[model samples]
Target: MTQFSFFSVIVPTYQRNDLLAKCLDCLIPEIQTLPAEQYEVIVTDDGFQITAQEMIREFYPWVKWVAGSRKGPAANRNNGAKYARGEWLVFTDDDCLPDPQWLEAYAEAIVAEPACLVFEGRTYVDRPRRSLAETSPVNESGGYLWSCNFAVKKQLFESLTGFDERFPYAAMEDVDFRLRLVKSGYKFSFVKTASVCHPWRAKGGWNKIKQHREATFIYLSIHAEELVNINSVYYLLFALRSFVNQTVPAILQFNFTGINEAFLEHFAYLYMSVLLWRYSLTSMKSLKNQ
Candidate 1:
């Protein structure tokens, strides 16, 4: 009989050794008391740099490290999942610090709810947001299954095809997965005891916004039927309404952050709408010609 771990914590990382080191420092000690056979940790690096490799080798040699697919976090996560040898695959980002009782909380929850397969863990942000632009993947009450901290049965993850690698960006991939899971109709238990601390991540810019728009496009395209009632047109109208209702008010107040976000997010929706309209027309034309 082959022995397998009850939980496999798969962390997807990319070119952030400093953050990854701090995360590992907090994560490893949490699992130390647990039997090694019961749990395992795997770090999948997208960058595959020598510094991180050597750091883990010299300091934390017990943890498993593998090369990420270099595509995106979604792909990297899928790559990490391939190496998982546990009943449950718990995913957390490399920048998150796991609470001391994180693994044990999940273990206890599994024992308590033997029928549950999906689990959403709590993600606490350590710092206050300086601006609305400074985003963080924090889930306090657990409706938001932010990829920072969540666990799903290995069987279910594989059955649902894991994170949709079709997403070119990390924007809507998790949302896509969540939508699929919701469609599956399994109630995801929110495990508040299983927690991780995530620092505020300042990741807003024009380029990032554009990438997010692309991902949203793919998400809408894939879920067109499910969202047929309120698809891209509804979002485009919402963006227009936002500009009229919120952006103009923020402009009068002279809030730079609000104004900046309005330009970055609201206006981009109009841009995306035009792009999508053109794409649809071109698709129709190509099909007619063929």
Candidate 2:
């Protein structure tokens, strides 16, 4: 029996107690499989109307619950890390269900690759074809290393300062944080065996699209020159290609659900383009006023 380091599984949640309960139900059992003192689960609630603390006390007495600042995941995660007593900070969402061997796989990886400081676990949706949330934009590896199933040494996480709270939404903040870590020469190890099941929630309509569009605009705003370089010809051509490639396939297959999803997916890009133009105009106006 090889000894493993302690891990704090940090989950940042909003107002999804039902899903959170299911997630903890799956997770608590997995954590308990290891040594009693080897791991702890810390859940930070981001201003939920119905907090899970009562439920946590009743069912998950071993897990730690904390109050969130109601800012976003980045801030919420930072708060969770503050109280984590483990040497490794394992990040996962309140909606994810870890595989039975998830912790064991990570433990094995740490022992096998002591030189590796960061680990990215695999994540997948069972029926990807059923929902838009299970599409291309939702990177399984989460671009670099998803917060939903990745582990980092507490020291490395601290040095990276967790995530940038400036990103107030659940968007590219993970990518942004990962990019910074990559730039800092942190090597990533993909633990294919350490997996988590992230089931897609019900589609939230165009409001969800609009929210993602804003997040895209924020990412674009950071790279303003790239925004300027996206020519109208290329944009139109790409949109046309996407419609034919993505939307047409679903329409041909008589997938009404998929057709609507594909349309919205394309619309997100188009809407973001419009937002970029508006932002550019606003910037120009500010420059003129200056």
Candidate 3:
């Protein structure tokens, strides 16, 4: 069996002290269950105009607080990993509340899959739903895993340089990293027991949609092949297909909640598609000049 020395829980926060406090609340007790040297919690603040150091120190004195560069989430995560002194690097966002036995589950998985370097824990929302259609505990989705909850060997994380800071935000950086790791032939195992609760808060505005559109372009550009011969209309068609796939079954089953969620998802896609297509020409020109 492969033996790991310790685990480092790396959380990147940006002015989310309240949520971070909740996260630490759940994590600290769990860590206390094991020996002190078994794991360390490192919170990296990404250029918060007002630091969380004081609050964290007062309430969660066990946590290692690090002031971060104004760089985006990816950079902040990388920064946290740099200070980590563990054989395994466990990542969870400040907004996530990990399960009581989250660490034990991951430790077990590591032993079970001795050859695997990457492992993803499940994340779901426990709060009341907005609509029956809304998705919660998104890590339940079988597609790509999010960095919101996962673990990798410290050596391996450093080998990939942690995350691609070029993506500039919490967006596509996870997807980009996963794709690259998969291409490099690394197997990832999902441990349902190592779950975390990522609560949802409805942000009422176009700002999120705008961020999605911007991230979509950045995502495609990073992939290179996806950007080739692609236009806004292509994304529109893609969105239409996705909408049908998501909403049709719900409609047939008379699942109003599911249908509502599907509609919202589709609308967001359509909105981004139009915005992306509208600026694709200008965006491409700018990228080419750079």
Candidate 4:
């Protein structure tokens, strides 16, 4: 068996111990197939309670577990990167389950291009409603690169100072990191074969709304320039009109109508407009920072 002497897989996790356990279960068999001594897995627990630690010890004894000092995801990732012993750091989320060939592909890609700074991989949502719909061309400018399936050279990661902890929440930090890499003239190759399946769960309305709002912050933080530019003004105006059209009818539903079709249509448009504005703001902020 070919040996990889220096590679580390770092997974930053929160309170999702069950998910983490499942992810590790999927990973261990793959790990066993590789040259064991040369590769390591680091699970950085982001200040979970004692129960989480106990669970990790019991369920994933072979993987190294690092306790996060009350840091957010960005900080947690940075901490894991700090202690990584490998020349290359493969980052994935706690919820992602990589294919068995995942690490093998990374190793192959590294061998093919030893000087590559970043490798962007593909992620497939498990059981998509429509596979054809899932295969659309992703807009890189729209921040499609997910942290759940990306690899970077260790030195490059350190040089860039890892992820910007300024993005405290779960949203746009990845975009900020990618933008920095782009500015630094680092090359990121899209590796379609290195895939992971991201499973979904039922989300409540409040949960989804919060997620969308945070995503707005992320979009604004990274895309500030576009927001201020002339093209963005047109998009902004359209979004404003859409928001008004949607919201006004929905509000009118409270007084004049009782759950009519127009109310639903308007509410949907209003929600879409909110997302558009949020993304525009993120793009505008990113431009300003540049």
Compared with the true structure, all predictions reach lDDT values of: 0.80, 0.78, 0.78, 0.68
Best by lDDT: 1
Between candidates 1 and 2, name the one with more favorable TM-score. Answer: 2
Model 2, residue pairs in steric clash: none
Candidate 2 per-residue lDDT, tens place, 1-290, comes to 89999999999998888889878887765453666678889999996677888888898898899999889888999999999999998998988888877887888899999998899888887564653334522336534687888999999999988888777888777777777788899788888778888876655567767666666566666645545565334455667897887666766555566566666667766766665666778877987999
lDDT tens digits by residue: candidate 4, 1-290: 55553778899988888888878876784443455665688988885454357876887788888887555788889988888999989888888877777777777777777677688777766653321111222223323566788888898999999988866666667877887888899878877766677765433234444554565556555665534442334444655674467435554444533234333333444565565666656656876999
Q: What is the lDDT of residue 236 in candidate 3?
A: 80
Q: How far is 95's C-alpha from truth in model 3 (Å)?
A: 0.8
What's the CA error at residue 264 for candidate 1, in Å?
A: 1.8
Q: Which stretches of candidate 1 lie over 4 Å from their true place?
A: 1-5, 30-37, 48-51, 229-262, 273-290
User: Which scores higher on TM-score, 3 or 4?
Assistant: 3
What pairs collide in candidate 1? none
lDDT of 3 at 250: 55
- Lowest lDDT sum, 10 consecutive residues, model 3, at 128-137
Q: Which stretches of candidate 3 lie over 4 Å from their true place?
A: 1-4, 30-34, 132-137, 141-143, 228-238, 241-265, 274-290
**Best TM-score among the predictions, by candidate number:** 2
Worst 10 residues of 4 by lDDT: 130-139
Candidate 1, residue 8: CA error in Å?
A: 0.6
The CA-based lDDT of model 3 is what?
A: 0.78
